[model samples]
Target: MTNPSSRSTVLSTSLTVFAPAKINLVLRILDRRPDGYHNLWSLMQIVQLEDELSISLSDKHSSITLQCDDSSLKTDPSNLVYRAAAAVLEHSGRVIGLDLVLAKRIPMGAGLGGGSSDAAATIIGLNQLLNLGWSREKMARVGQALGSDVPFFLFAPSAIVEGRGEKVAPVRIKGSRWVVLVNPGFPVETKWAYQQLSISRTGVRPLSDVHITLGKASALSWESVLQAAENDFEASVFKAHPTLHRVKQKLLAEGAEAALLSGSGATVFGVFRDETAARQAQSSFQTEPHLKVYAVSTTSDF
Candidate 1:
């Protein structure tokens, strides 16, 4: 989906933007590419659960400064948000600096695309604040360099992501649904998940079948999407961490329409019929002190 260029009308030098969390409705890992990055086909969606970004143009400071509520997340160049800001400055060929205040609410390494969303927000925020007038296509190019999932956020709130995650084809699910995300309060290293999958790559789906599934998905309702939800990582990931499997079971037991681990996850999300049921499910998980749960709705309009 090509986002048409739109000029920013905000006259202020500062802006606060919403950086929503994302879930993989369906994740299919294809063959390992020659570059070692696995090719993938997935249906990715944005949820209302989000981080807030307060970004302002800094005239006095010559370099970007980033502050995060989560101290565990680095504020330096190592951070994707920082890299995104730098990429914009470098791409725009402007010497302007930025003060980025990231109010992080999403858990890291839960496969929620928290970091990627922050990066995309930074790019979008900077484009408006700096008046760069760059189209989404240009911003997405910068996003691709930051991370595989970064480009996906540029095209959100839903899309069919493919080809090492750089290829994005935006699609609309006919309706919205509620999502209940349960984090086991632990991090799942993405590299480790890939290594585990490499050892057990026995059931890799044919790329053609993935296309067929997604093609049919375009015409389906939210219920049909839940019925069609699949994740290639679940098999190996659940085996490695049995607790995640129980989380999925708990979600199902609590009246979730469908439940699955999101991406290479330590977090499992369940689809629900409405906000009330999703909130009820969130309450049920509260009994488990180790779990962090959130009740959020799907967002089709970004």
Candidate 2:
């Protein structure tokens, strides 16, 4: 541990980083793990929607402070923010306290990878602020240890994530087009979603399905491929919440290109042809008391 207040301090740093939310176009739990985690492969895309993180130099060695609008999420060591800072310290050997502020726009436990994104932001923010000069690859290694979804954030936007979600292969899918995201006022526990994956009994795998509307890469962005990609977690999640299942149907009826569960769900997203249609869908869902809809375009920059 080193004193951070001194001008001569080596690791004292300050920076502000934006932590964005992530939406999974598809999630498939391939297998159950002995470690109580399911092996999964998913199509993860970044949305323009995000939360803000403010971190600055502090006096102690590695103290972390977090403030957020959600009173329910623990701001202590239980928080990924805290854990992420610890992870950076354990790796970098730079023991400097951090003054962190969390502006939480992303719903906690909404299967949006908000917490994991924030943790990744902290690691990157501190790395640059501390002048450690770490590369993207190094940050990704730290991110993978933090969470399955975290590593994807460390890469370029629009990646096809595989394995336990650590492997990321960048796929160039352009256009900041619209997507309709709905969280039905309930958080879906990822662990519970995995348990719902009864692969042996169900004896089926969800297929991937791709649809093309309008984008720069016109020829390749065909409909058949997108339709083939699937989220295996959807059936069980929808079975548990009949209302959520209905929302997915409604979005499709509203002319969404594709309607499917995002991540482990309760938060389902409908990919639309354009932003106007997405906004219209959002307006339609506003009448529902329990549904929270966010009309966002795809973006990987945080």
Off by over 4 Å in 2: 1-13, 33-36, 60-62, 204-225, 300-302
Candidate maximizing TM-score: 1
Candidate 2 lowest-lDDT run of ten: 1-10
Residue range 39-100, candidate 2, lDDT tens digits = 66666777766777777778765576777667887889878888888888889997677777
lDDT of 2 at 52: 77
Query: Can you write out model 1's per-residue Cα lDDT over 38-81, one digit (the tens) per residue?
Result: 99988888888888888888879889999998989899999998
Tell me each candidate's TM-score.
0.94, 0.86
Checking candidate 1 for backbone clashes, the offending pairs are none
